[model samples]
Target: MVTTRQGVRLLGPGDVDAFLDLARRDPVANVFAMYRARTTRLEPRWLGGEAWGRFHDGELVAACHVGANLVPIESREEDARAFGERALARGRSVSTIVGPTEAVREFWRTVSDSWGRPRDLRWNQPHLVIDGPPTAAPDPGVRRTMRAELDELYPACVAMYTEEVGVSPEVGGRNDLYRTRVAQLVSRGWSFARFDAGRLVFKAEVACATDDAAQIQGVWVPPDRRGEGLAVAGMAAVVELVRAEIAPRVSLYVNEWNEPARRAYARVGFQETTTFSTIMF
Candidate 1:
């Protein structure tokens, strides 16, 4: 187990419950990290990362997931600095620094010299969540995507990814991986969409989920459907369905510049609880 002189220790299977409990402390904010922990608990090989924790008098105070993505949860400056040193020592394995805005920013400050400037720094993402039902009227059409509709939903999924991430899901030659992901979500009833007259109009996915919360991602509406209230209504349906069948709470992070989406989420009863930042390499 990797350990620092200051008592930041790498956690393993034996610490699964504590790791997940730390994540559950802020269920909405830690949904992604909690998802990772739960998955690791069930199948350790699936985590493909190292989890580290900082303790104060034997109580876990902070946690971090370092691998393809570096995510710090409820971390202090000391935790960030220690994680930064460990991550840097392992070389540039992390492709992104993503989590609570302040923690990620502080971690970046410590690792910048070794990690280099990022390709993009998204410093302002509002993390919003809704526990109860949405205020907006739900669209009956927004339901789980079926395997038969995979062919039709692929393009919309690609469009959303390209627009949001600035790169197409098909960037690395074939889109086999992306295709598999969409198909899996559909099969698991995690992909939700509105198909009007057989055309995919709105789409969203429960990207990650644990017992307490679920993180929604890839929310989208076709260009022609923009400003038509499709996103607001469709998402209300998505939220309702997710809450009923998946988790009690649903959360998503939106770019601060996306006013339309911000308003849409607001209409659905989502309120910002925290800010998140992403440093993409």
Candidate 2:
């Protein structure tokens, strides 16, 4: 008979494989965590925070990525509660707590009082994914963004971020960091957009990826172009390019209150697989 040693501990580089194996249990849903794990390789210096794991029988079962964003991976209510306790003790260092709905809720319940009130609580974000070809016709004009077009794209990005997050990315003097992030995505050929007569119309970027999936972020259509089917066709084009080069599956999450955005994604053949929640500071 084998005895199980159950506890939560801070994971390190040596735990990378175990962490990844746990994440792959639901690749599309866990894409963000997996991407961070792969990129940072469980190094605290690179992670800028820490990764915590819950174990049973000396085997990893659930993990949490604690950084600027607190993301729980395959965590049950109990696991999330425990992670939340740890987070509370460490103090609220993250700007956001996001992940599967139940886990995020449980985690938040654990830390909410100590963490203080968040700027926003998004409790019903639909987590959507697409594997096969997009249903809508791809827009021929929608293509990878060129580095030279950064000047054109930067404004739209700022607009989108400010609208979605309720604050300018430049707040707290993060203008350079945010701009550099946009450029990095463009340099990696992950930014996509459609422009008309030198005016940017639609745009999005693959925020992160793993061998199995990629998560799209910053999806936006200029206010003037919102009802012109630009987003549907533009996203279709992005799906084609992303599937052809990045990962086989594409995923994204949208706020439940945004019915128009939700409908557009549905038309593009994305189906909601789960719900996610975010508590943003």
TM-score of model number 1: 0.95
Residue 254, candidate 1: how far off, in angstroms?
0.5
| Residue-by-residue lDDT tens digits, candidate 1, 1-281 | 55567668878778888888787779889988888887776243577768888887787788888767889987878888877777777777777889998889888988899888788899999999999999999999898999999889999999999999887879867599889989999998999998989999999999999888999999999998799999999999999999999999999999999999999999999999999999988
Choose the strongest candidate by TM-score: 2
Residue 200 CA error for candidate 1 (Å)? 0.4
For all candidates, what are the clash counts?
Answer: 0, 0
Extract clashing residue pairs from model 1.
none
Sequence-dependent TM-score of model 2: 0.97
Q: For residues 32-131, could you state the per-residue lDDT of candidate 2 as single tens digits?
A: 8898899999999999999999988788989999999999999999999888878876899999999999999999989888989899999999999999
- Please tell me which predicted candidate would have the highest lDDT against the true structure: 2
Candidate 1 deviation (Cα RMSD): 1.5
Clashes of 2: 0
**Every candidate's lDDT:** 0.88, 0.93
